[model samples]
Target: MSAQDIARMDTGEIVEYEPVTPMELEFMIRELGARLENAVPVLKELWAARYSAERALIEEKAKAVLRSDARTITEKRAEADLATMTFRRDFDAAKETLHAAEELQKALASRLMGLQNINKVLGHAYGASR
Candidate 1:
């Protein structure tokens, strides 16, 4: 009997067991065994499908993490590039200033040498006249 039928039966008195032939008992056992055997492949397929879906989800999550890391790396590289460019510009300006200072120093040294030569010539001329 089906579980629903058994549940709907009155609970006033215990039911008496009905006797069946040995052949009928054997047939029922074989039928139930066959039904269980038929269900095994279906259950296996369902389990495999569930496993595949879980693996796909894990792979997708990994891909998303990798994409995020790539974006972060790109941004960091851009920042580093900008910092390097700024440093190069400052270095170039400082180099130009240093060059200008060196040129001024050379000009001052030449002027001082010319003044000294003029002073020596005047001293010799005054000594000769005295």
Candidate 2:
């Protein structure tokens, strides 16, 4: 079979092939680490932007309620109450998302650290074997 066909085989499928070289593994780790490092900051910035937008929306809605005509006070109050509830719900959801992203970032950091340790150990083993 061609090398491409062999590479495409599923894990359980029998196919004779060499394992990934130490250099190839190191390169993959480095690439993944770089991508993860870049992603965390961008994710944090996006979360902050979303939070700011939501807060501004809530403030604008509050001002609108205050400026509404007295003739429609009852209707305006009801609308304001609904808007407040909706805003609270959205804010809560955003907070949850931010927490989730933070947790993911922590996990990624831990994984990256683990990969660095593995790379060091592998480098030592490869050098000793040579």
Candidate 3:
């Protein structure tokens, strides 16, 4: 996808973001990081909720029913790790968010630098006339 697609995500509903300075973009990235961390607490919360309430019952019933076919907790967890892959969606989202922030920052910095160069060139040309 292009930078605008990423920038749109960063600004939520505002694809046409206001003029962002490099410093402002830096702060926006920090805010995005904090928000992402807050959004993803469910990862640990889900693990704790499942492991606390259902681990013993699930292990017992599965072992009794399957006998030799039953897998150990570690094996089951590993399988579930692959099967659920809980972090996949969150990881992708975070990557996208970070990428959007990075793109926005780059664009703002470039614009600021270009303006500075233009002013410098104009100043030099004006000085040469004297």
Best by lDDT: 2
- Least well predicted 10-residue stretch by lDDT in candidate 2: 5-14
lDDT of each: 0.45, 0.63, 0.48
lDDT of 3 by residue, 58-119 (tens): 45445444443336876655554454344444444555555555455556445445545555
- Give the least accurate 10-residue stretch of model 3, judged by summed lDDT: 1-10
Candidate 3 residue runs with Cα over 4 Å from true position: 1-78
Models 1 onward score TM values of: 0.37, 0.57, 0.39
Ordered list by TM-score, greatest first: 2, 3, 1
Q: Kindly provide the TM-score of model 2 when superposed on the true structure, using C-alpha atoms.
A: 0.57
Taking the tens digit of each residue's C-alpha lDDT, what string does model 2 give over 41-76?
777786886688688667967776897665687877
**Clash pairs, model 2 backbone:** none
- Clashes in candidate 3: how many? 0
Task: Using lDDT as the measure, name the better of candidate 1 and candidate 2.
Answer: 2
Look at candidate 3 and give me any clashing residue pairs: none
Which of candidates 1 and 2 is the stronger one according to TM-score?
Answer: 2
Per TM-score, the best of the predicted structures is 2
